[model samples]
Target chain A: MSSNKQNEIALAAVKLFEQKGYRATSVQDIADAVGLQKGSLYHYIASKEDLLMQIAHQAILQFNEQLEEILAKEDTARGKLEQMIRTHLIMSIDNLETTTVLWREAFSLGEGPQEVIQGMTDKYLNLVADILRSGTETGEFNVTHPRITALAILGACNWVYRWYHPSGTLTAEEIADIFSKLFLDGLLAH
Target chain B: MSSNKQNEIALAAVKLFEQKGYRATSVQDIADAVGLQKGSLYHYIASKEDLLMQIAHQAILQFNEQLEEILAKEDTARGKLEQMIRTHLIMSIDNLETTTVLWREAFSLGEGPQEVIQGMTDKYLNLVADILRSGTETGEFNVTHPRITALAILGACNWVYRWYHPSGTLTAEEIADIFSKLFLDGLLAH
Candidate 1:
């Protein structure tokens, strides 16, 4: 089978995993989705778990790249954080199924794949933490715990996947702006 | 079966759902966990999804009562928001298995149960939005979209279930305090 066929199978698997919980989705289900027989499906992928890991790896690569690109810019820590939020918002809206699959089925993957996904998650998480640390060092922020603060920011961003509507009134950019202000400046005025 | 027996089974189901994904956890497994045979388990719950729905209802009921209690206070919007955050943190930490199960397995529940859970989720979500709206009406906030702002705060709080550890250095209260400050006042300082 071609590599393109593998990607096709993986995307179909993601959709199935998102709809039916990962544990309930079978290889045959995936095979049918990709127009392949049960035995032939293994020619392109090792197993269902392997495909899930691939999805996690591919999704995290995009997130890692987005964070790295933003971090490389010569901007304030707050600015970098805002850019990161925007990137996450765009990814969540544009890549809804993959994002949903990543978060929803993350725990179902085995230890090896879970660790790989964890590594990617930690990299993205630490990038956010680093920005907060920079803010504290530069007197740009006064957060008591940079790690907690970073997690909160990412949490708010990730939670968007649960409720964001593609045809909704707010664009991803608009929602990103709302989140950045809420995290950096807060809801209350002085 | 008594109501207490039903509660025991629900808690066991939550634990199983958190450890094993909902679809992977069999009704027999839940019964085994609760020291009941498969046939006896049905006396207490209609089905596995029924038990999952009960957990969701029970968890959301706690959240609803907490929000209402906080809202009933003579506190400011900031205060009410803080109380809400604190309540969430405590619940996430103290009820780790249940919280994790509720979030991780929310999609696995059937439509009728899903709707019930969503109704509870919406009630809690709207309470946060009300706090933000109060702030705006009182001229103490500047959010253009209180609904979005509320979701961000909730997203942060609910996401805590994914990473919180009881033995971690930070107590639930400390984390709640950090979140409260981070949400109410933000990271930037005068």
Candidate 2:
């Protein structure tokens, strides 16, 4: 199979596995979706697990790159937080399939894959934690526990995959701004 | 079937469903887990959908009761927020299986049951939103958009069901207090 054809098959397999689920999806189903024989499809990937690994790797790499870019921006902790929120929303919208798969199946990656994914997740968490820590040090915020705060904020941001609609009323920028203001100043007026 | 027996069956079904899934789980599996014959299980529930509905309803009722009790306490918005946070953590831990099912299969509830569950969900959201609104009105809060802020805060709380384990390092009270402080006061130190 041509390299382009291989990528197409892998993409179709990822979408099917992510949506219909891994156990429910078969190689033949993937082959049928991509208009190839099951036998010919094996020319591209070795197994269903390989397809999952490839998709998961790509998703994590994208998330890491986005995180790095957001952190690299020459901005204050608040600005970085806002940028992180916006970029996460945009990526989730643009990469809904992989994001859904990541959220749903990260636990199924077995020990090795779980560790890799956990490492990525921890790295992501630490990135947000660093911002919160910096915010606390700068006297611009007053949080009691920076680590837990980071976890809560990241949890809120990562969960957009569960409910976000591409054509929904709230834009990415709007959500980022709303989240930033809510977390920074809180609801109670002093 | 006796009412107790029916509930016994339903509880077993929740365990099986959470460990496996709704589609992958069979009525026979549930019956076997409860030590009842497959054919005899119908004496308690009509179908798997019925089992799901019962379990979800029970979980929602438990959550609603907790919220009501918290709101009834003679306290300010800050105290109420702490109550909400603590109760939420305790409920999630005490009813992990039901909470998992609630988070996982919520979108799959049929129309009649879906409406009921959605109503419960809306009530829960409004409960939190009302607290924030009250805080703002009393000059104890600074939230600009109550609806969006409520959703973000609720999102933070709800996502904990996916990753938290009660037996882990943090106790329920500790988690709740940390959540309340982080969300209410934020991460920046003044």
Candidate 3:
């Protein structure tokens, strides 16, 4: 019951942070959304920053876990990258609010939480770079700079959150396929 | 003289908004940054939102102007796209604070200003799509969805603001070259 309540509170916070910017949201507002008295809300979380940290931590962990699963696959680098792009698109769409809060409000976190989030972000980037490096070594890919290539791929994937709509013509999977093709194959007709 | 004051105030606001965020920044802070009395600041701008509007408008207009210049160039689609990427990277790095402010705070504007910014954003996207469409028509590019491909390219370029630093090993020109190559030739060994 305790963990369930905490989960409820976190969900409410994510919604509020998405609708109202994090700085504009108050602890009282979060408590009201979660059906708790302002004072009682403290029992579940230490502070507003704590809630922000919780949301960011949860979001990044999900991304890390998904990437790790893709990394452990025995596929070639191109295959793994496609899978990563698809998983990332699906995850971003599935957890749009969480992703928004993490990207928009994580910087508002205090030093310790910010560092933790940054570390996780770097880990994700490094993992992608590792794949690119391995692909180059095995002659599966022609990437010259694995880190920059990783950033470009991730940037293209991450920007989906900004423009994706449920009512849009293409579904997440279709969009992922288009993106995978664009990244894997050059824009040239050849 | 009055326009100069406004320019100073706008630049100061961009810095403050980048450092402290839009909502966290106060008129007093902006006035202080520009060495003006709080009341005197109103002579140049109407409100904090006005300053945000100014910053966003300036940033988008700059982007549009740069893009327009590239669009007018008498080059192939590949050449235009490469120039676009290079110009975008340099412009983004040059105006990092303005770029950051525009992306981070444009949503906070009222309906009218929000719509205006959105329109400008669409205009930029459409211009990019035009290049891709032309490329595909000429058999120079293999893009299926010009709009989506344009978004991917812009996303990769815009994300430079997040990780770019003067002290970094790679210059903006070098990053732009890598991006252009990656987009044009892709990751596969031809």
Q: What is the C-alpha lDDT of each candidate?
A: 0.87, 0.79, 0.89
Better of 1 and 2 by lDDT: 1
Question: Which pairs clash in model 1?
Answer: none
Residue A22 local lDDT, model 2:
62
Query: TM-score (chain A) of candidate 2?
Result: 0.92
Name the top lDDT candidate. 3
Query: How would you encode candidate 1's per-residue C-alpha lDDT over B6-114 as one tens digit per residue?
Result: 8788878888889987888999999899899999999989988887778878888898998898888898887787888988889878998888878888788889889
TM-score for candidate 3? 0.97
In model 3 chain B, which range of ten residues has the least summed lDDT? B157-166
What does candidate 2's lDDT look like per residue over B1-190, in tens digits? 5998897898898888787766568898998888999888998898888889888888888888889998988999878887888888788867888888887665456789978987897798789889888988888888776766777877787777776776678877887888787777665453
Q: Write the per-residue lDDT of candidate 2 for residues A44-149, one digit (tens) a residue.
A: 8888777877778788878889989988878888888878888887787688888877776555456787678778877888888888788768866666666777
Q: By DockQ thresholds, what CAPRI class is model 2?
A: medium
True contacts kept of each: 0.95, 0.61, 0.76
Ranking by lDDT: 3, 1, 2
Off by over 4 Å in 2: A10-29, A108-111, A137-141, B72-75, B108-112
- Ordered from best to worst TM-score, the candidate numbers read 3, 1, 2
Where does model 3 exceed 4 Å of error?
none
DockQ of each: 0.87, 0.53, 0.82
Clashes of each: 0, 12, 0
